[model samples]
Target: MRRGLKITLVAVTGAALTLSASACGGKKADSDDGGGGDKKSLKIGLAFDIGGRGDQSFNDSAAAGLDRAKKNLNVQTEEISAKPDEPDADKESRLRLMANKGYNPVIGVGFAYTTAIIKVAKDFPNTKFLVVDADQCKVEGANVSGACFSEEQGSYLVGAAAALKSKSGTIGFIGGVNVPLIQKFFAGYQAGAKAAKPGIKVLPPKYLTQPPNFNGFKDTGLGNEAAKGQLDQDADVIYHAAGGAGIGVIKTVGQAGKWAIGVDSDQYNQPAVAGVKQQILTSMVKHVDLAVYDFVESVANNTFKAGTKQYDLKNDGVGYAPSGGNVDDIKARLEELKAKIVSGEIQVPTKV
Candidate 1:
């Protein structure tokens, strides 16, 4: 189930419930409980991507960081989900709402919020802003920080795993959207597959949706259709970078007795796709959780740095998962490749 605390203006009782729930972490800035007078607590607000808090992938990773901050750092948090095809104005308003409500270090979870973060950060000089995935927000020395990742490097490892495990010698890639960001995943996968097997047939990738139509990230039917089409063409292994929709790809691949590579969080351990655990070979684990945690921790310590913070394989920020033991036999070989990539012996392309 997707779990989150909601705040609304019309529902006073609901808002009160949110505050009460938040109190579980710590006392809000406005609370007066007798033992202390208006105990101050760090307030964090996050704006999630289309899949929201529990899509079992990207958004869930960010939510995990927030949960950690609430427990380990005793901070209060509020998260809002984006609507399908929402306008940029909506995102700007969401960031403004959090800033106006005195929430410091407000975060925009996906690259979709890049423009909104840059625009909103200018108005609230006191508020710190973070945007994940898009490192191009060049507001040097400003209050905005971009938590960037080397997604292509991680995708390369999983692609090698897929090629190593495939029996049909043919593998495929399924992307959620046809944007440059998702394309990075395909590029790395293609390179890694070829590096592992010279004769391996990495079929042309399939993208479920293009820009302005991001339903591909959340639509299960599209995932199913894309995976089935690839399997029909004799592709025995498939990798998906489709957020919540990737669940559908895994389910279909498992039922067909083929292999499915997961993205973002470790899919082999995800409860939403637990029934198909054995079918998942490995996942391109992106440490979005670490990025969110570090950013919040910096604020709590009063040493927040503005600009871009990059996470890559060298820093243990991204790699392939070993869950389900599906990749145990070939892990040593994967490690060798990982070492080479980290040492600059191999250059994983960010573009296909």
Candidate 2:
């Protein structure tokens, strides 16, 4: 748990400054048309996780942000699909490639790139690096910004929804990793469920962490299996914090003739397994797209900042997904619970 302490640095111009690597120039980075700048072209590079694109979870959400960086920020962007074991290889290779090739700013997705970003950032001190969901990587280089989302805050609302909607007294949560971020989601959901139903029996399943496989994030089959186990135990609904793995939870719920919740983005509309198109009760959303796009824009304008920047329910960064599965009654209850939480009437559990 190496955390970089906040340091103050002077910019030589006698300007009192923070030691962090905050982008100084206000110049924006856009590359929409042909070649980025009237002066020079801007390029952006991305490294996807092991599940790559089809997982329909974290990687997909990150890709959506990268798409925004391309279209809105107008930066020529390239993505490298990372496999289970070699996820960081893409980050290392692409970071060096982009810096060496004169790319203004490069983006690395997921925690797998934490060490890679630090190593590459040192090699190319001139190029800027933005790492998403890497709050732990706080190296004091003059060119790095860390991005993360408050997943727990969003999970609380969905927990409330699940509790209210479950005809059975049982509901469950399956997580990809047992880290703070994912565990926080489970905790908040448990709190929400308790708040709504007073004594909701929620099953917490461990999809990863015991074995500690990097590919657990992409294990759709494993996710489904875990969710199925919960459903078989009579859980009416299941909430999933697995990345691409959540797709399996979605499938299990739909196929088993039960219900499930989604994370990151809206899973209700995405086409998954057989006939489970809309089985998702609702999704707990963390707007990683908005955060990633904002970082790209910031880097282009040369005003990116470091340190822990939190995106929570208040910032619209995290919340319950819209009820696309026609759970109007559940949505109403969720909204009510959301209001209560924000108003300090309820504290979503965020710890074991």
Candidate 3:
């Protein structure tokens, strides 16, 4: 029940003819010939959530996938970004625009697009749409696919690393927004840390902002202030699920000579945080790139399935990055925990 039936031929071929006729000024007739000049070219459209490409986190991971598809598959691509507090209408408009411009398999890079994808997919029944981090769209139709991940599973591994490497026995978690999604990260981290070091002192989690105030995901100053507050309270090791804002957390930890765990992408290898590389103990690596690439590849091969595609620890979709060589000694123990989680021996919590 994961995927809907393949769309009928009339929807695909008729829609393509209509679009081509409108675009080509009736110069070319719609031919049913397969391959040769009759084969349709693939084009992908990406709608990034807040903290777009340069955030060095979530959006960057998706972009990496598109870049790979462009190189290996020789596909054309268009990318758009969401502004802070942008309304759902704006997202819908972006998707509509992409589909109108003949972009197939349009992707919305974050869960915020759940509403937009649900509304827009019905109008353009021929074009395929992919929404990352949101699975509700799967029930909408045969054209929408959701790419989700078990973030808690990855967070658990890094949390254990933080607990094991902490000298003060005190750790902190900084979340971008006080929402269920980010809470998953905190919940897993706390559970893992406690499991690694019993009775460890964990500071109360702090969020930069709540709903209607998404600046938490992009505000570097807020992240800096939050990390400094935690450090002042004797929390020597901190992990952040903020997007662009995490740069400040890493910087503050480095300047304070403490450890900081990264999320979404490997902050240790990111050039933006090169100066603070050593302080980044490790990052919960979420494979957004792999998911994006697979979706695009499926479209190229005419095997695009519309449903939920999950990335979890067992599938190598989410994992802890080996960075700075700081966690080399404890890698074996982390691997053991990973195996346990994959086998359901350890259940990581997704709620705070």
Candidate 4:
């Protein structure tokens, strides 16, 4: 699902410099030159999280936004993937390199980039920076923004779906990393499962790895091991917020004829997981693509705002996907819960 060249920082910088010398005598525009007369498309740089683009989950969703921007906005884009277990300095290098190359509105695709963005944004005061899943860029007058989502809301819906469709009373959750972000997914899932089936047994969330060891997001072996453990414990339905690792969970569950719930993108429709489509009960779809596209559009239209923007079910930003129609029987019920969450009647927990 992820197709593109990985532009190295040094190569991209030299190439961008050559292009800049020819374009506007090395002058960097604060925003896109609107109005169609000598309009210059914005240059965008996206740094991916641990699993990068081909994860078919989180990074792939962000890639969709870049794909749309390339097609509709005619913007130049460069994407770089993070090396597993890389330090924050490496992230800072990635962001600094992009800004130095005149790429405005550079974005970091995960919460891991919070420190990098804050450090790099201070140096490139004119370059706009956006971090997905983080809101720590509140330096006074800094040109940085955060695109956050109500992940708990979407997880809640999918949790209910799992409980309603589950033949067994036991359900399980697997988190890639034992961070607050993944915990949010577990918190909502447990709450929603209990809400739907008061007697449903939601096992303790299993984390593949702890922080600073984000291998959990990419290690399919770990995912498989975790899923098998849950299945052995009589978990008929399992949900995962494990990025690429979830691919293993889906396949393992499919082989065992149990149901698996996907995260970020709709695993039911992802070609990578096509073999297990039927077993995928549902997915908590977080609209990272919309957030990326909207952020780039804001810069292109010279309407860029440096602040945190929250996307929730109220704006169709985050919700559950019924790709395989496995959850169609309970879609109406899910929507009702969605409406109540939007109306503030149901307060989903963000922490377990």
Candidate 5:
């Protein structure tokens, strides 16, 4: 089984129920109770990226928001995951299925859904569609919203931390895919590392895979190999934007008694990687949870609107995680750089 397309209905109380019967193509079902009849009856649908909820990174961060919304906002939710080799048509079908089943505020959790969202949002004019990490749906649609983040801004902070903490002057960067988005991480990281330590040696950026080869986002074997290669070159600290693949990178770094920087979520707090928690210097915390929660809350409060919503360092949408207290000594310096970035004094590059 792919374990990707499983439709799980999350009850308001945080328990997940497998829906044996679905309305559209045997994949999803709407909750009947509607939050114990006290709160607004809203059905929110989420389509996750390749790694799904257990990735302990990107998808898990989005799940955090959905779970929080269910508990605090009293809403029902249906969640589905994307297959590894899923095509654009499959993504469109997933979103269409959610909208057809009366799931309002259908949210797509990755940039891969940009095309699907643009296509599906047109058919269902009533249901709101939100796309995270992408701004493709920010056009003239009344029911579409793009939740975009300045990932480079947060990556810069962690890069500075990596430079400050590295015992060996050389640090490495591991990116999931060779796409512009991942490159943005590289650009900021390189800039921040150099800015923090003028002579810091940032090894050439290495990506697990390129476009059309998205396995980089979920391939632990590749992540391990990449991290090991950098370590062999005497790199003491490593930062990764490789989604679930980052687990392998972190593990390898930890076992070698080296520092690692996590991405998307606070990997230090993740139980899945508890053994390596001590090695995680800090994480580039992109608040996908906050964005997802805000969108759900907007729909519930009848304040939903279309267009682009930016979450950047200035607005606390992106930040560095204070994990393991590894960066405590350099906290003041990091904050100074952050303030400069926010004030436009330090321009974080989005391209390598």
Candidate 6:
């Protein structure tokens, strides 16, 4: 059930929840270009997953970071969506379109573009290729830089916090896919819950087998239905690592008067479901923006490197969200867990 890290969907969180509940990984290279070895200008292309611009997660975070790159680095950028419905579709048409249109470095956000990238990169050797969450992705003609994160460590701390703060002994998690990456989130969350309070029960309403499959993530009705189901089982706090799917869970929790935990980018700040502004206890931050920003900067400076990369709590790449809604009450305990995780006192287990 731990294939969550598959390149076709929500890559990181899908894979990490298995050891207790299992695992997840990305790549890039640089070419020397005369003065200081950095490119004067780069044409960047981004293809987002189906949830599109309204997702407020995953694709949104990637776009936010890339936007920062455009503003700060003066790079040209463009983006398109994969229609989430057909993750495995040969976006070669889109990738080819970008290449033909003069976008130098083409990027594929989720793992869904793995095979497509392998094909497109081969066809466009001169154009650099990038895939987030697909470390093993390689294209012969293009240099593929996969951006990955250590979601387990981040989720563990948040999970631990959830367990510690739960009035009821039950905590919950929802995944976008049931692959290793998403599974890691569940596994780490469970471990953290158990660590926080021995014998704590973690309820998983659903597991996603398809990468980027927001069928469940997209429907507020389903997200709510699933969350309500967990609550019905007596779960007090629900943690959703389902990307846009988590947004639905957050909204449902708000309506149901329960606590919800956000993931990836903080959903508490968005206006989609502001009514439950106070319902979000905290978020499991992946700093996807940081990754995007770094990749763009690296390309500009000609310092890009290849091979899989990991962003964990230690590197300040991932962490719990900032207090926004009604987090004041839990800030003290949250801070305590933060200290332990960052200080290495608490090794938020990445593999069970």
Question: Candidate 5: where are CA atoms >4 Å away?
Answer: 1-39, 135-140
Candidate 6 has an lDDT of 0.71
What's the lDDT for residue 54 in model 6? 65
lDDT of 5 by residue, 1-352 (tens): 2211224733222122235433334423224554346554678899998788899999999999988886676566788877775678778877877888899989999988877897899999999989998843254477888898898899999999988898899999999988888888999999899899989999999999987778999999999999999999999999999999999999999999999999999999988679989999999999999999999999989899888899999999999989788999999999999999999999999887
Instruction: Estimate candidate 4's alpha-carbon lDDT, on a 0 to 1 scale.
Output: 0.86
**What are the lDDT figures for the candidates, one per model?**
0.85, 0.71, 0.84, 0.86, 0.86, 0.71
Candidate 4, pairs of clashing residues: none
> Which parts of model 2 are misplaced by more than 4 Å?
1-40, 87-91, 135-139, 209-211, 343-345
Scanning candidate 3 in windows of ten residues, the lowest lDDT window is 2-11
TM-score of 5: 0.90
- Worst lDDT window (10 residues) for model 1? 9-18
Cα error, candidate 1, residue 65 (Å): 0.5
Predicted structure 5: lDDT: 0.86
Q: On lDDT, who's better, 1 or 4? A: 4
After superposing candidate 3 on the true structure, give the runs of residues whose Cα lies further than 4 Å from its correct spot.
1-39, 135-139
In model 1, what lDDT does residue 149 have?
Answer: 88
lDDT of 6 by residue, 1-352 (tens): 3211211222223112111212231212222232455555577877776576568877788888876775566465667766545535446667777787778788888766777877787777677777777733333333667777778777877787788778888888887765666777887788777877887888754754364454654556667677878889888888988877777789887788878998888878878868898888888888878877887777777777755567777788888886674656666776787778778888766554
Candidates' TM-scores? Answer: 0.91, 0.83, 0.88, 0.90, 0.90, 0.82
For model 2, how does the per-residue alpha-carbon lDDT over 1-352 read when each residue is reduced to its tens digit? 1111111222222212222333324444433443433423456666666676556777788878867665554456555556555544545765676577676677777776778888898888777887778845354466877777667678878888888888889998888876666778888888877878987898865655442366567877788778768888899898888888888778878787777888887877676643685677888877878877888787777677765466777778888777565567666677777777678786666686
Per-residue C-alpha lDDT of model 1 across residues 31-132, encoded as one tens digit per residue: 323134433567788888988888999999998988888667646677878877778888887788789889898999989999988999989999988898
Q: Which stretches of candidate 1 lie over 4 Å from their true place?
A: 1-39, 135-141
With a 3 Å backbone cut-off (N, CA, C), the pairs that clash in candidate 3 are none
lDDT of 4 at 230: 99
Which scores higher on TM-score, 5 or 6? 5
| Span of 10 residues, lowest total lDDT, candidate 6 | 14-23
Q: Backbone clash tally for model 1?
A: 0
